[model samples]
Target chain A: MPFSISLTVNGVSRNVELDDPRVTLLDLLRERLDLPGTKKGCDRGQCGACTVLVDGRRVNSCLALALSHDGAEITTIEGVAQGDELHPVQAAFIAHDAFQCGFCTPGQIMSAIGLINEGQAGDDPERIREAMSGNLCRCAAYVGIVDAVIEAQKRLADAGRREAA
Target chain B: MKTFDYVRPATIAEAVAASAAPGAAYLASGTNLLDLMKVGAARPDRLIDITHIAGLDHIDWLADGGVRIGALVRNADLAHDPAFVRAYPAVAEALLSGASAQLRNAATGGGNLLQRTRCAYFGDPASACNKREPGSGCDALGGENRLHAVLGWSPSCIAVHPSDFCVPLVALDAVAEIEGRAGRREIPLESLYCLPGDAPQRETVLEPGDLIVALRLADPTAFARHARYLKLRERTSYAFAVVSAAAALAMEEGRIRQARLALGGVAAKPWRARAAEDILAGARPGETIFRRAAEAALADARPSGDNAYKIELARRIIVRALTLAAAGTPQRLPALPASPFSSAPGARHAA
Candidate 1:
């Protein structure tokens, strides 16, 4: 049975036909839609390499079945930046050198964005470390990741303040 | 993962009806369920996706000071709810302490209660697990069973229930509203989990096609002022508790009027320490009384495997949790949430 579902992926609406119910959002994005930026690390929920924004919240796309998210808006790594302008989190990751192999970079960036939007961790390094503990970096880049998140949060807050002013 | 027929039920009634078939399971967030399927621990032929069901995502404050939390309410949302946090600080703390931010964002309250144990043998199909397959021999009895249960265990199975959120709910005497093929009914949250006695596979009391709609906590304001959830884990965060405790006290003047205590990672269910609560009811707040309460809490705890250390750890945690609760809940939750280091003197200052 082919199930047809509609989703708004990275600001574009897409209608998809899933031939198997076992197809996860990670596979749907990387394989069918050709959005390969969302890396599949564990395929299980243990690793956050498959993290993405579903309805503005970070979730493990590998654990999310595509059919379950019909009509929902999703934001992946491919949607985080404007043309020729990097998102604050992405820019901060590069500035801090937060990645070595860059396999977990996409998930870390998306999780950082989600954490910043949640507004729970505000320049607190401990809080940022705790919040970003989900996206593990095997390269031992946690020091850089924490610094990057703190810097990105400050940047995003400053940008918001400027817009408000 | 096995290919399954997915049905998105529009209503709870339809969901319950669709789940009546054999080899059918309810799919909410799939944080735990999908992982189990990927490991071949769970193989359901039909999945009834109940995430689309409306009216099950609300957190309603009842007129009688109680609160009803819908089954579909995400763990992160519930933990971050200001009013809910104020009323049930221990619950919120416990919720925040369990999983990572992303997992908490996707995991639901009802699904948290139903999450299976993290026993390595149970996740491996090659190993014999009584909880996974009833008649199969228990491999965890002799395998790497350092983190197995200590309070309640039988020769059949020793896997502990791995839910941090449930420990505080059981301590608060939360009630579960369930709907089934027969009708709607309510049961105490403590009664929902069954001891692994002989039927390890039948972990919960829910029958087939039974769905948990909401969890109701009755008037938690009395203990809200002095409630604390303290978890001892291998790491500071994103780790399961080696032994965790939730302690809430309603004090009168300088004496303890009432106490609620429960332990996690020690038994098949959140082991409510009724005897410990009884011992602390009229006692003065001190280390001596707290020690007695801790001893009473672990009086029946016996190790199932190489986890004799957990019994002592559980006792010390109960004592520390009671002491922390008597001190009072923090003005805001600690940056580390329920970790013991969070409440260490000068810990926040050092941070």
Candidate 2:
């Protein structure tokens, strides 16, 4: 018999079947929930196509089992923005042309936002590059990825300053 | 991946109970195991997920000034620990140089130590890899063995250890605290990995019911202060190592008091360079000492095909690491300014 699990994903209470707790959260999202924004690349974790925010901390969804995350809040690419306004990361990515094929874009954006929120983002290019090491794009579009992150930080700071002014 | 029974135990005892079962494997972060399962390399009949066991993910101060890190502690947490950065920089640096942010956030201390080799032949489903199938003949012996072992290999298998963390732990003389059906005991990190003499099927000495619970690091030493880990990967990051070295040096008035060395990407297990250590002890730090130490370490090196580059590459990595360790410490900035293009990910030279 499959076990029943209760989870809060994208701020909604949900019930699911978990016969095999070894099924990665990525599998649950893409296979069961039909949220295909999380791509599966190198299913072995060599690539970061399946990044997601678990309780606001970015993790590789393909490596984390859905069962172990009971009661934890999860936010995917689907939950990043309001209905009309895109999140700053998404907007910056679009502005800077951060992606080519758009397969690994969601993961890269999620990771960058998580880093900025975690206070791991810094002005140094190396730390930014080092922290962004997990996400790989086949088109080798790292230059644009870094540019998008820097631009997002600047935009957020500018918005904060304007609101205070 | 084969369908298997799974349990997420809320308590350590329950997790251990599940892990004690025959054919049951304890799942930490599951970064490595899950990946292997997807490729049809590892299949466990039962997986006992221990990520929810809260207390097992702590880093406590030992009464003896050392640190006891829980097996389930995430790699990112350990890498950024202030005490680890101050005491054993090599270990902190090793953890930082591996995988990437998201993967390390999900990779556990136990899982990092037990990660499998990246021998291309071993991972390919069609190839004859003795590690995957015993007595199935190792095609890597006469095949495209660009990542095969240069040390601690036999006629059977030549797969290199792929971890960036275990290399430094071996040099530090760290120990593992494990609990299982047989109860709790500590083993040296050096003896944890087994060299493939003939039976390449076996990777570690871990029994069927053993579960790694903690890793205990020893007190800081002069050698630890001068330690460094340098990795040369295909694209500088994310990719596995083409050649890497974890080395520690002790110096007095330009004379080497003691030096410890270990090689990765060139060995079946993290190769402990006792010969190089002995040769460089109390020796001067210069081209002569570096050349001889490299020669002694690679004296028995056996490379195949395009991997011959690793012979020189591994030597250069060792020399560069040792040179930096002996040459000079980085100037302290007003604040911690992260390096932009460091040769190694975690070589923060300081007091």
* Docking quality class, candidate 1: high
- Of candidate 2 chain B, the 10-residue stretch with the lowest lDDT total is B331-340
Task: State the local distance difference test value for candidate 2.
Answer: 0.79
Which model scores highest in lDDT? 1
Tell me the spans in candidate 2 whose CA falls farther than 4 Å from its real position. Answer: A19-22, A156-165, B304-306, B328-351
Interface C-alpha RMSD per candidate, 1 decimal? 0.8, 2.9
lDDT (tens digit, per residue) of candidate 2 on B1-351: 787788888876787777656668787878888877778787888888888877888998888888899998888888777777777777777787788788877789998888888787777778898889998988898888876777778889888888878888888778998776667888898888888988888888887667788999877757655777777776766767777777788778778898888887787787788899999999988767877898888988867555777787777777777776675433321111112136433333431
Which candidate achieves the best DockQ against the true structure?
1
Model 2 chain A scores worst on lDDT over the 10 consecutive residues at A118-127
Clashes of each: 0, 0
